[model samples]
Target: MTSTGSTIEPPTTRAMVGASVDQPDAGIARRRWMSVLKHAGLIALSVVMVYPLIWLVVSSFKPNEKIFSDLSIFTGDLTFENYLHGWTSQQLPFSVFLVNSSILVLGAIVGNLISCSLAAYAFARLRFWGRNAFFAIMLGTIMLPFHVVLVPQFVIFRELGWLETFLPLIVPKFLAADAFFIFLMVQFIRGLPKEIFEAARIDGAGQFRIYSQITLPLMVPALATTAIFTFIWTWGDFFGPLIYLRTRENFPVSIALKGFVDAQSSSDYGAMFAMSVVSLIPLFLAFLIGQRYLIKGFATTGIK
Candidate 1:
């Protein structure tokens, strides 16, 4: 206490008070520096990753002879002739290939959404003999390489006379042949509240009704995830189309892209690059449209 009976803070106490006031300022400055460094690192990495794509886009606009002659992406004389030439270069217009790819992608997406969701619902909510055993086997198939079954599947399709058709690429989706999608959907269904199922049952809802109405509606995120992934995979599948599609008219965009290269003639790299840029538009649009649901699906399901 001071002489007048007013209390005074000691020097040490005043110093401690000053430190408490100043600590936030120091911390804020440190965080600001950290954020700046983090953003700079990310920007540098993005440039490194996107550089090749930028080059591809630029080269598509450049004269074919100027592609490798000029490594510079910016200094090229740009033209839309590559795109015009590429679209009509093949025996069939490029639109044919695009339409073929669209059909396959749409079929695969619908098939996967229907078949995978049903199978997932069964595995998630139903009880039957050997349920766990079957579920384990389904999960095991995810680890099995697609190549391991490639020959057998090809043989099966050949035997069924389904070769040179979209069936080989899309029908399997209707059978829930995609173990990864099945597993993804199973986890998502399992995440749903059991009480909802019970309430549905109490209201006399049949299993099919519950599945078609309750489950499907709430599983939009997972379904969107499946559809988007199926679109991307089916659209980009080169090996499947190469193996099955024999006629030029039957070829999808993936196979048609490969047609730009011919050993008997000069390659059309400019046209190829231009079509490649065109091919990516659908994928970009799909991702952008379903981005919210894709993130939610992964967040809800067990997949990262």
Candidate 2:
């Protein structure tokens, strides 16, 4: 009887082991299938997202008649004439527009970095009176629609004789008018370990020294992120430039692109697409350069 019981136990143990093995295999098969579906979905989405860009690039190369007719982006007969035409057709040169845009973007970046960082440092590190109340007020401003203040802001700028100049666009950034950026930087600065600042203080470092030498270096990722955003915003600001810049010569690439589509004449789609591609180059380059820092910045920073 004992030998029979032992024999049955071995078979039962073998069955249990087989069941365990089968379960794991089933799980692994399901997981593998899920992974494949996920990757397939991502690839499909990527292709969809890139298709318009591919179409634009192809259309830029095609002649007027062939642009919509050509189905294949890769097989189109490319031409440089569209770019040349786009560049030379306007009275206010494309180069002039490019320079204006560059100056505006650079000024905005510099102003936002300096002003926002200072404001953020004060809010995060200092323990002054009504700090929390002030911060809440600042955050509240973000919820207010831009249209609510646009008329007042425009009137103020007009009263100050700031119309028809870049001053109206660039000056407010220096005053930390961009409360969102200030708030973003404040959250980032607050996330940093306090012990480091304390250690610097113990080593006889002043506030400016600590900020310049310690905090600034560690905050490069945040600064880069801010600069990238500011550059993109300033570069693509059509309404601001349209409102302030009276002269055709001061138009940015965004406003200049509109010149390709005139009201009276039939617009040249190929040239319009070509100019559109040209407008994207600077932004693409900016993102490529700062993408690494942007990723790192977002990883460490959050609202306090």
Question: Cα RMSDs of all predictions?
Answer: 7.2, 7.0
When summed lDDT is taken over every stretch of 10 residues in candidate 1, the lowest stretch is 1-10
- After superposition, the stretches of candidate 1 with alpha carbons farther than 4 Å from their true spots are 1-28, 262-265, 299-304
Each model's lDDT = 0.86, 0.81
- Per-residue CA lDDT of model 2 for 73-168, tens digit only, reads 877487877787767566765788899899899889999999989888989998899999989988888677778889998999999998878998
Tens-place lDDT per residue, model 1, 74-128, is 8848999899998988878999999999999999989999999999999999999
Local error of candidate 2 at residue 96 (angstroms): 1.2
Name the lDDT of candidate 2.
0.81
Q: At residue 9, what lDDT does model 2 achieve?
A: 47
Query: Residue 134, candidate 2: how far off, in angstroms?
Result: 1.5
- Top candidate on lDDT is 1
